[model samples]
Target: MFKRILSALSGKKSRTSTPVSSVHADASPPSDESELITVYDSYGREMKITRNEWRDNVLLPNLQQKWSDADELYSLIISGLNDGFVADLIPAAAQLVAIDSNPERSHVIQGIVLLENGQLDAAETTLRAGMAKVGATGTLLTNLAKVFTERGEQALADETLWRAVQTEPNLENGMLWWAAIQRERAGEEGYLQALRTVAALPGSWRAQLWRARHYLEHNDVEPARALYAEVLAGGRFDGGALMMISGDLGNNGQIPLIIELIGPVYDEHKHDAMAGINLLRAYQELGNADEGQALLARLYALGFMPIKSQLDQFAQVFEQMRKQDVQGVPIDPESLKFTTLALNQPIWHYGLRNADWFFAQKPEGASQVGFFAFSKSTDGAEHAESQREDELGRLSRAIPLYLAEAVHYWSDHVGTCYIQIVEGGGPVLSGAEADGQALFDIVPPMMKYFVTGEIGCSGEDDQVQWQIALSLWDCATRTKSATESGSAVKADLGALVLDLETRLLAGVGLGREAPLDSFYLRPTAEVLPVYLTELGQSFMLTLLANGHVPKSSMWGERAMLDWPLNMALHWPTLEVAKLMYICGLGKALDYQSDVLAEYKERSLQMLRELEQARSPALRLAPLVWKVFGMQAELHAYIRELPADTSPEHKAWLDRVSES
Candidate 1:
């Protein structure tokens, strides 16, 4: 398994596919045009207005009737395909031989799609036919050249693209694409032509962005900055140009420059939740939870509660420090007890953005019987109708790929083990229904026969069967609450823990023939510690569970290798009280007050701290609060027992909090 898989896909509009021309056609105006037509207005952002409004504004009444010029008709249709009256968009893409909508460009898209799909002969056939019709139209020839290059005919691909630019002097995407290829083949001359292409299209944002991307990719910072400034000045904020650039900078670990570039934009557009999240990411990488918290506070003040998974992690970093360094709690990593022997971090878990694993260590060294999941995502944004289909398609393909990787890494495992699922196919800020079924689809036999009803949704409420624990949180970006109505999984970890205990006691997670709490299951018999981290922050759950953890569990391979390994990395400096509350709840999850348990005194200390907790870092579905209530009930349960029968009852009551 691997942490993150950033495939080096073509990230450009024209680069990804050969070239595309969307389909649209002129139509007679309807009598009662109530619903408006939506089209891409300026910068790929949709703009909507009624057809009559378009006529009233641009054509002025009879222009729709008078628009009979074939050249104008084709131009309007093609432009509308790019802007409004848009017909369709594809996921991955459909290879085109010849679509009737726009045969010239459609043929190009078809040929490129064929080439990409490894149908070299089919693609060549499609491209040749298109060239015959369009006569060196940039789309056809450039793609033909690509096929040529793929077939070891590099000179032909280059010559064909050159012919494209020579014939269609002002073909924008073609020139950009041609220039890109030329830089390698034509060297300085190609670069000069790219510059000329940019100049030719004065006031074109796409052209500038393409050029800016070239500069940024090559580390030509100054020119990139100038182009970025002009794009920003053009008021394309809503168009997502800056956010796209921010993604590039953030991914490359350029935090400081991102802060500088987007600070003014963020200030001006405080209402943009996506922009705020981008800045929050920068601050998180900087390990400035105080500023990060401040940013969250502003969003709260604006009445927008962005999903705070990142914030929750940011707060956890500071919390762990306070308990160990400031409170003199003498926190020891050795306190954790694992049911299994060891854990192994495979290659797949390396660079994940948000990933978590639940493990059961075998008696053997460096082996874990657990599921580690890290998601691989493809943005399904701006294509609402097609997203659900595309999301499933990508996931279906990814599942087997991960299984293959697991087979290679986890060769020693006996049966089917481990599951990874993708989350949030698009930006969480987009307010789409975030998918969670994949998490539940672990293994039906495991869920139905054993851990049924352990998480929340039972067999009917959720059809998934695997012993995996999953709760889907639907985050509402524009609202005050981070969660709208969520699925049936327990919102708190304690409840989840109790459920897991019941399942293990019933021999749920153990493989089919294994008895109750087998080595395979490694049930957290009494206490189990839980951890959560995203970007810069991490949460530690100090709950009671069952297991015989090796001494090396404190630090080993496949261990907490990031922040917990280097606490000094991006040291958090915000609220510490909230983390104490999490610690309290974590302790409560691990609470062992059943007459003979030794951690009752520590549990009481966690409860006392919970009362004074007043931080907003975890207001979004605060699980710690639930832990407090459960701890109280736990204390009451032990108290109700007769002191005469309880083991060492007197010493337990008078016990002091462990330093």
Candidate 2:
């Protein structure tokens, strides 16, 4: 079946007839008058020989023509000479030498006999001497060049042709050979120039074809297509040329016409992978998913398996999109989220635990997802370390190494940052204080300098000066070991936190201020929620005094404000409500109630509209209308919470329920 398909696609036809033999039986001899053999001498004169006299005189006397024909002696000699019958032709050569009217012809005949006898050197010398006597012209020069070319003296052969061309520039065959030689030496431009000159001559399809090939080689597809169209219009269906034009069109993104041009070739060569793969890509890009899938399945059947990593990557993208949909958000097409998802499946913990973090942001500039598999080997470990070092080095060399390090270290505590090192181990090593200190000791001097802020690595002149402030904080925090008393460590961490706050207020723009608030708020809220509770009270009083919280404080306040909303009902204090109202959660909760009511009314309106919709397509409208009903149900759930209830606490509960 496959072979049948392939044959159909390739356009091969069945052979029809047996070839006829040139040899014939029962051939009669020529009459005596017509049996005379005329030989053209080198001087443009002719000589004639009769059958009997030539054989008796030439054959018997020289001992080399014993095989001469009895009935047609001269005709047999001519045939024998042409077929290179050496023994029979030897006496003819001697006879020719005896007839000394044309010495150049005698020498040429002797050279042909020597060439037939495999004496190339003798043949070449004889031919050269004969050519000198004959006064070498186009015919003689061309013959000698052929000999030299066959002997692998291409330069000499080319020089001989050049001489021929100088004598007769209009020699069509000589011009073609010169063009081919020039093409071989100087490439496409030289070849095209020569080919164009040849093409301008009368009746030159070969030159036109050569010109078309030159265009195709340089990716001049439009001109190549024009040339190919001309050839096809002239009723020449060159299968190879057609295939080339189809591929050129496909490569240049002419998706629609690619199939039309190459369809015949595909039909001819069904198993051709290039044709199949390209067809698949074209269909896929056109959004013909069913056709694409069928083609891909066919390719699989033909023993081509898509890489497993690619499959996994596409799955991840789908999963990220699914998660983003639930968060009532649109995924940024340009974000790394889309890029990562498009490439592969999201990581296990992504969307499962860290979905909120992804959802909270606009999904812009998120890191692209990728996969890496581990193996137990020293080489693999080294490779992994080298890759990590290279990434770190780029960050260190371009920016501040300390700032980069601080961001990474801080993210480990608050975000889903993790490093899954596949160590072949008896016991696992942790990245706790002791390990960090040991690792710090072994780190390179430049890294250590940045970590400790000992060198004050900062300046407009310094390449990594942007990292100075973060480096200062990292140094202060690292000074207090994790193994030290909690109070001591807390004191150091608190001081650094205060310093960072002051720097942030000073508007350094060290990093994106909006997103970094979570990092700042997480540690402070988790480690010292009590302090934040008091801080929230003071901030609310300050906002009340000013009549509004500043725009810069809005995101930061929201980060801390969530805790008070959840605790509001339990606390019932003015401070809790004030923080909630200031951060906009109080307003959000009231807005949710109103939206739920509106959704309920909209659901009823959609039902009425559905009944009025008479067509089948309109009947499907009710299905979309059910989404409003769902929103109403959600709103009711929110409204049932007590007025004094912390909106943050309710939100957390809803989040857990949704999960």
Candidate 3:
């Protein structure tokens, strides 16, 4: 049944899941996908995920079809760029670059590929060279400005974007880009005037969104909502207007506001696939599968078919949930004692097989990323001189170190492009044209991707359209640690993580570089689950690191660190395993009588911390509704818990019941 749904989207039978590298091609095509020998190139071999595997690995409903020409192919490629067809996009992008009939798109797409491949300079050159040839068109300059921002060249980005706006005053995108810079640099007061200019422009969907967002940011509810109302009613501009306005709250991880604003619309617009898709993904991001699925069922019943690719994207998300819901893998019931020799030195790779911090040496130094099973190692004695510098402190610092490297890695690869269907498939999202012109060139919200995780991709950026990378550790840590002495709290950790990310993003020079839903800020709706999984992992990790199990807050304990150790529970990769360990831990403790007692409050506290702290992980989702859903499930479990519920917890549950 699933395969049939997927086949309907891609118009191709699901192929065998074998790596193309492992198979040798025969002279003739085989009878079926099984018989056919799939070829893997050098890149494919390196990724270990062949186009076939990436295609069939469960990114929803397989949405690829052979195109007659590269132009048509390019259009579809743009569509797939964010839709989990990234690996597939490589060859397609290359195809477009090779066939340079329209050199303009060729340059842009090639630049995108170059950016993806970590060639920032080459991408800049490609875009600049194109601009010299074609003049500073909004599309070229908008793209070029993105590279500049990724390179951390704010001056250049601002200048180029200014040029883009002047070069094409009518191009709302140029104006939007210009406005984003002004907002970031000058704040709302300085940004508003420019936005007004853009908003006043004829058929400026994005400009209007900026104006609406300006209002939203200032806590001016009526104008913001009114602006959204006006623009959404005007027509379906490629950019989802409501998202541009309300969704902008992602910068602050404003899950509640997003829910409040969109929830009613979601309730009212059940038949509007576009609105429903965003709402569903938002719910999923919030980690509320019940509501998301409820909406999904309604959408599916409505026969919402926008495009094959989007259907495939949605299918991939559902398939993942189905596996978890139906044929789920059983986690080991026994708690695993974590034992490791904590090395004090800065580590990136190598050393011990059991070591938490594994640093792989690069030619110059070492790989930026150092994959680890746990946060700060338990090297120091359990009772350190300062109690504050317990396992949580070390783990917190260690985590930033590891993740900052990823940000640095990502920073170098700014202006990265790939299709992720943010808005679900809906008649190919043919948004209404402004000024009787189709802004096929302007992809509404911006483009960003993350280091892929099994459940969903999570990156450090705070905003949906604007991506933040954790780059330049020394700068971020030094700057932040100096601000606050001694131990860095998780919020400080967020700052350290985000500053470097911001730097890494602006880092091209500091260094360099560097879901969904039309619901488009997310690439595709499927990523909602990934965000939920990531956010859940974060909340659990925070909660457990503080205390959980027989011995809570046993960070430095050698005999029994009863807390959740990084999961050996494989989710395709060890990184994801470590990342989502808390969720697994939560599941394990749920069975224990002692742990079940405070589970409701504990989980609720974790959720509250997510909001109070404004966690970076919270930004992973469009919303954290899943946190509430988890609480709901915990409440159900609380009811099932054998007697001996504490008065406080009982009171809380009573309060919940009353509500």
Candidate 4:
């Protein structure tokens, strides 16, 4: 039944379209189509092979399908350049000459490739022809200036660069180029003079924004606010831009200015989460209790699942502030423990969409089995000072999620994880204080059975001992149904989980089987630990994308974004891992996340592979493709997909498009 549902839903076409512009250009493909690949060839040196070999081995196999896809093709070129496989990109860039849309960008890409391949004359002609047809976009002009500089025409380059900035004062590359030139010729004074000139340009909010930063730096609040208001008036700024402005004010000790400039207009729906954080900080620092509590309540209502920890922490601070004001009680904010909010909420990949539908379809005899986070049991001893302690905390949450996914995949039952939030901003590793009765009080009505456990580790670094005790609770009878416990070395964690999973499945009467049509597959021992970590990271990123948590909070954890793609690329045959990868990439792309910028090429390559294999991940591929500036391809791809029958799947696809 579930397979039939997926089949129906996966076939639905999207109800949107994106237009592609037409541009005509006359240019021939590269004359030397060498099959023999090497680093030196695109660097103006050669290792030769016949045209037939090149066509069969390289062009047809790699570059042919992506010819018209500017984003995919350029991603390939850039990735190849970064990895020293430039020779492979010559044909890719050659395809750019014939692209219809993004003519200016296409020309820039081709010119850069030409310049890199030592075709100075060809590069110059290409840039000039592009300018004639496309009317000189800042990016096009900037690259054309580079070609001039490469040809030792310093005067022409200088003239072209100046024109580039005047033509598009907001282009970072062009503005940076002009700034560097002025600074070299003069100094800091000249840079400021050039910035002022550009800031005066009509419709140049970026320049105005930069000037505002400068004013704030010099403690000139009025000028900064005026400039910021002008930028806001342009209405071209996005949430990210507002966040940047807020960051500048916050960093410059202009906290009140942040609220003054942004408070009136700030909407959680329209502004980045960081802007709210700034306002909250301002209210808290000023002891504005009513306003602080109001803002905190708004943020909490967002229900960002992954940032449960961070939001809980925020709640604790605000709660403390409220307590001190009303009760006149001295509460050390640090002494606050459990969150008063975001309690008992289960972490599911797809948010509450179709939740009723899910439980409604459960088999008559089957039961809802929830797996809550394992408590960190210290047994009253001084907690071991192991570096792996953090790892254990993450696993406590991750293990439950993994187990829940497994249960749902292998049986006709509801499986979900309850990783409650702690006051200090991390998963609530519930110990004795958050006991069974306490947990049972918070579960939803459909949950008839639940699992809980305690986990701890000893020793440090490479030598660690891990222990976990698990119990199954019958919500109907309000009794412990079964129990399982195990101890293992850090290297043997997978073996331990597998053993526990087997017993838990048996205890609940679930039979494990691999279904060919199901998206879920049992993760292997080799992949489980790494995949668990990825799951936790994926959850974090998904929350971040939803605007529930500040991006700054996850700065040190970028591996959460990169590792899924890396792991999927490494273990291509693992369908389970690929699911996580697609989910992670979709969240990152949907949110315009910068964390995945470094892995763009890898992600593109993975997408291509998934496309070819017709992987299940293709169901969610539209979300990933749209934000990579591949709107045309995104529209075309969506039109080809059939309507998905699964409400969960359809909701995700629709939500990304709507967002």
Stronger candidate by TM-score (3 vs 4) = 4
Worst 10 residues of 4 by lDDT: 1-10
Question: For model 3, what is the alpha-carbon lDDT of residue 175?
Answer: 72
Runs off by more than 4 Å, candidate 1: 1-109, 116-141, 148-177, 185-193, 202-222, 235-244, 247-256, 260-280, 286-659
What's the TM-score of each model vs. the native? 0.30, 0.21, 0.31, 0.49
Give the per-residue Cα lDDT of candidate 4 at 253.
Answer: 91
List the candidate numbers ranked by TM-score, top first: 4, 3, 1, 2
Per-candidate Cα lDDT values, in order, are: 0.38, 0.37, 0.40, 0.63
Instruction: Compute the lDDT of residue 331 as modeled in candidate 1.
Output: 24
Question: Model 2 residue 323 lDDT?
Answer: 37
| Candidate 4 to truth, TM | 0.49
Name the lDDT of candidate 4: 0.63
Model 2: per-residue Cα lDDT over 1-659, one tens digit each: 00011111122121111111111111333435235554322111234655544445443443343223221223333444432244446556555545545555555555555555556677667667767777765544654565677678989988997676555444445666788788888886787787776656544444565566566667776776676556556643333444444555566666665555444345322334555556655654554544554444343333221221232233334333433443222323233111001101111111121223222232333331111111121211221121111111222221221123233223211111112222111011111112333434543332212121111222233242222222221222344221101111322433443444344223222334343323223233233323334333323323322323223222222223233333432343322232232223222222232222222332333234335543222222222233333555445555676788655545543553343
Q: Which digits, one per residue and each the tens of the lDDT, describe model 3 over residues 1-659?
A: 01112222334222121111100111232223332223222111111333344346523232234443555555555434433244445566666666657767767766765665557788788877777777766667767777787789989888877777766554555675577667788887668888777666555556666666666667776776676667657654443445444456555355555666666555323223455556656665676655654555444433322322343355456545644554322333233332222222222211111122112222333223221222222323432121222223333333433433443344332222111111111001111112111212332222122221111112334321211222121222222111111222323334433443343334333242221001112112322223223432332333333233233422222111112221212122223222233233333343232223222322333344445655432221211123224556545655685587556545544433332
lDDT of 4 by residue, 1-659 (tens): 00001111122111111111111111333455443333211111223455545445544444555667666565545434433344566677778777647677667767777776778889878888888988977777787788788789999999998888888887766776787789899998898888888888776777777778888889898888898998887787756568878889999998887788777777776677767777888787777766876676566444332233454456567666755554222334355454422212223344222233222244555567888777787766443121212587788777877777767766556676766553334344455424677767887777878898888899877578888899898888888888899988878888888888888888776565763235555667767878778767766665566655556444333346546656766677776566556566656655566545434444565666788988866555566665455677766865676775566655655655655
Candidate 3 Cα misplacement greater than 4 A, ranges: 1-91, 98-104, 124-135, 147-156, 166-177, 217-219, 232-236, 242-274, 277-659
Model 1 reaches what TM-score against the true structure? 0.30
Better of 1 and 2 by TM-score: 1
Question: What is residue 401's positional error in candidate 3, in angstroms?
Answer: 65
